[model samples]
Target: MTMKAKYQSVLDLGESLNIQNGSVTEENGVLKVKGTANTPYEKNILWDKIKEIGGESPSDILANITVADESVYHRHTVKSGETLGKIAKHYYGNAAKYQDIFKANSDILKNPDLIHPDQELIIPNL
Candidate 1:
């Protein structure tokens, strides 16, 4: 199978993620993919898809994925009944880190208990 055909799923994923500056080429049984994901989570999604298709470390694929934003880990749009603790638990796997999220978004969040629907909160890097 050609490299391009072999890594077709990755290319499709890049498209689905709306990757910017995306380029794909295949040479000598190796596929090279380069793109910029809008967020770190989006980049992670690409990597996870690559690993899923290629195994732990696939030598046939060379992916250059980048995040467009570096300051915030994720920009979460708050939903009704969502608290800092819930958001912290979702991102960091620890509800206790709510304070960390609260502190990072102090400019927007006045209290840990007052997040409303549609509010954008910055999930700072830990």
Candidate 2:
């Protein structure tokens, strides 16, 4: 198996990630995630999801994946020729952080082998 896939599968065994569980009921323009508390993670994660899926129909990304506890992760658009090591050095200032990125964004990035342009990834600071 690839490194990214291995890391992601490992994380799946640890904790469950949160997503919009068809919990939001709207009449006109009101939207809300039912049975949820308001916290820093609530705001940041919501905004992040919206931004990543901008100007389009409902893709339901957060709905299908695990929800993280803290929203310390930042988003990165994959550029051609970009590698996990490069992303690690750019964000965490250490090459070792690539593994964290790989772990955080395994949904779309199933391996550290190669990332494509225009693909968005979540790079966790922690």
lDDT of each: 0.88, 0.54
- In model 2, the clashing pairs are 17-66, 17-67, 18-67
Off by over 4 Å in 1: 1-6
**Best-matching candidate per TM-score:** 1
Taking the tens digit of each residue's C-alpha lDDT, what string does model 2 give over 1-126? Answer: 432232332223222433333243333332323332223334445444444443234332222233443465556788989899998897667987888888888888778877899988887757
Q: What is candidate 1's lDDT per residue for 50-95, written digit by digit as tens?
A: 8998999999999998899978888899998888889999888899
Q: How many residue pairs clash (N, CA or C atoms closer than 3 angstroms) in each of the candidate models, in the order given?
A: 0, 3
TM-score of each: 0.81, 0.43
Task: Determine which window of 10 residues in candidate 2 has minimal summed lDDT.
Answer: 6-15
- Highest lDDT: which candidate? 1
> What is the Cα-based TM-score of model 2?
0.43
Pairs with steric clashes in candidate 1: none
